[model samples]
Target: MDTKDNHSLPSDDTTRLADTNSPTTANPAETTGSTTDPASTTSPTYTGITEEFNTEDIQVVQVGSVLKNRFVLEEMLGRGGMGVVYKAQDMRKVEAMDRDPYIAVKVLSKDFQANPDSFIALQRETKKAQQLAHPNIVTVYDFDRDGPNVFMTMELLQGEPLDHLIRRIRPSALPAQEALSIIEQMSRALAYAHSENIVHSDFKPGNVFLTSKNVVKVVDFGIARAAKDSDRVVEDATIFDPGSLGALTPTYASCEMLEYGTPDPRDDVYGLAVVAYELLAGSHPFSRKPATYARDLGMKAERPKEISKEVWQAISHGLEFERDKRTINATQFLQEMSGPRSGRDSRFPSWAYPVTAAAGLLMAVALVTLMFFGNGDGQPEIVLEETSSLAEEQRTRIEDLLEVAEVHGLVGRYIEPSGSSAYDAYQQVLALHENNKQAWEGLHSLGDQMVVAIQKLLDDGKQDQAEILIARGLEKLPQHEGLQALRESF
Candidate 1:
């Protein structure tokens, strides 16, 4: 099986599953040859083009029919475990009235539709996905089942899959901070779903999307289950092998997910973090395969630190196979994300920090002079000194900037071919205080030479990517007069 095969679901004998193939432009005249024709000597009178953008030149393939009413299907956009996606259009609107360009339609296979369990999964996804309205999640507009056929309609996203992106960039080779930010955004989406009692059981790179606008959308909730629901057991659910269909990527799956067989918030954390580790360190934290593959490898694997000490620690606690050792929940995870790499300055006050610092100070004081006051006499003085460090003005500012830089750099790290003010600001901060421990750490955390590295990946084409990078820079360092001016120039 090609790892890149988007659709991995098994095909039953009764149902017809189309092999995902690129769209073939059979009827260019239908798409390009319109009623409005200019004085062109060309035989095929096409529409919507001068000499620059010609729809006739592009090949268009029909994938599936839409609404069974207006739209005719085009080429495949992607294929996954469940359905196949294709660029489609409303023939009524396009050929006749000449309206919107295209839309995406996801069609279920005959085999999948025949399985009652698949039908239930489809219904559950549609209901939950319909309720989710966010920029980071794929929008579900309308869903319909025409006889045995089931399909979903959505905005056409002209972009590359995140799976290819990771492979292209080789995320494991990226900087920790960059890797962490991608995970953070993904976490934010997962957190939202978890709040609604949703579990994206099939959370993976293929399910994540990046639009031209740098907008991230977590997609393919088709197979996702509600957190409280039990895994569906359909005797006929074996479009694939019965035992293997339930399996998720073991590299990312939590122990509890395998044992309890329930969807938990920690499951998402583990899976997403696995992606994070891969993006940051350029490899999976666990060298072992999912279930069956684990037997050959040792039960325990090398830690993230084996790649880099900074990442090892950043990902260490999160990668704990045991749920308890991991971040308690997304809320706590965000709370831990409070400082620089958090994309915020430490100057921002949180009750947790002051409280922890105070407690630490008090503990130090008590330990120093148990006898000085005999019974907590000099404790107050000692505690004051210990906690006072957090209160220092210079130290606080440095820490805060470090935090902001960290977070901004995290964002910047993923900005392909980056040369943004955010990237520059992060770089400047590091350069300004080379010896400053906080700055150095932040710089180390920033991770990835993406701005420069991505150039090599895309044949040195950085126009669109640079624009995004510039926008990202402006987002973090709005006060940067130069960046502010550049944003206006664009």
Candidate 2:
């Protein structure tokens, strides 16, 4: 099996079975072509999706169908393990004269609804998703019912999911920096959710979305469960656990998840590692084998040739078969990748050095630290020192500019408005503090964001717009190799 299989465990002995694949198989939100929209070119429906849904569902989900008279299903974007996501126009938004009257609505599948606990599962999913407010997590509106059908509304994304992008680039790896940025964003989201005592339970490329603005948004917390150590008070007294439904994509699931062990943050770490590996190496580390099966076979991941030792260590740590051996938590994984690479290079243990040399090295380090932290009194007093030696005024100015750049970035103002754009502000901050960390990161992030937007415009046949943006980007950062290469491709 290509690990394309997804299973659902029944409450009874093969009696009360819940089959999720057929309902969650095809995605309507990911569909670029549409049957109802006369403007969009028609693409073949995703395999086994529409066919499995009974005639009744087909009729219920027909194009132009009105759900609760508030949402109009105009086009199908994708159908997946959770349910069918449609590019729906919120009639309420239209009535309110909203500029972007669109939203992505995921209609629950019949099989999922057929589960005796389906209603409660969906209610939990909606509440859990609403609690996650990070920028990287999708904003879920509300769960509602129109007769027998139930659906959840979310922000309509403009770009393809990570899985689709991986398929397009496969057999060849993504640039190291691009892959790292995507992974970093993913880690941040997972870390945030873990902090809230939530486990994604299903973290796969299919569940990750990269918006046109280059923001990475993680979706589908349908199977999310409270962590084993969660101190959060349970408002709902339901005894049913949604994860018992077992709707996970096997390839990306950790062994602990597969065995139905207690939920842990490390489970997400394992999935993150798998997705991270695929992003950089362009293939699953275990060749699409389930984690348990791979571990039984003693399979080991091969390091990609282009990756640095430090980066590979971080990735490899997350890929560890045992949770104890893994990177400990998502935040540690992110820090390993995002922190300075001072210890990135492989080196022998200090004990490996001659005794005298090792002692001398320790003495030298201690003397340097003492000199740097000399409290003027004859006795030592613990005084925290700023890492940067820049004067307070200079530091304040840099901080102000960096803050301005961040606000601009959040609103997608990467390079417009000339001197006031994120790019220009980052440049100013860098000018004030040559090695300002936020300024450098902002520039790189802005470059990535602009490239994604520019590519989407180019793909849509809006070459004039793409070219204009490209020219503006080059004017700001002419030496940026990513932009330079994009311009040269034309």
What are the per-residue Cα lDDT tens digits for candidate 1 across 30-112? 11101011111211111122233332342322455455776577665554334456667767557676667576776654334
* Tens digit per residue, CA lDDT, model 2, 201-249: 8787767877666667898765445221121233331122233233455
Off by over 4 Å in 1: 1-66, 91-101, 175-178, 226-247, 291-311, 337-490
Q: What TM-score does each of the candidates earn?
A: 0.55, 0.61
Q: What is the lDDT of residue 400 in candidate 2?
A: 51
Candidate achieving the largest TM-score: 2
Identify the runs in model 2 with alpha carbons over 4 angstroms from their true place. Answer: 1-59, 224-246, 340-490
| Clash counts for all predictions | 24, 14
- Residue 23, candidate 2: C-alpha displacement in angstroms: 11
**Window of ten residues with lowest summed lDDT in model 2:** 33-42
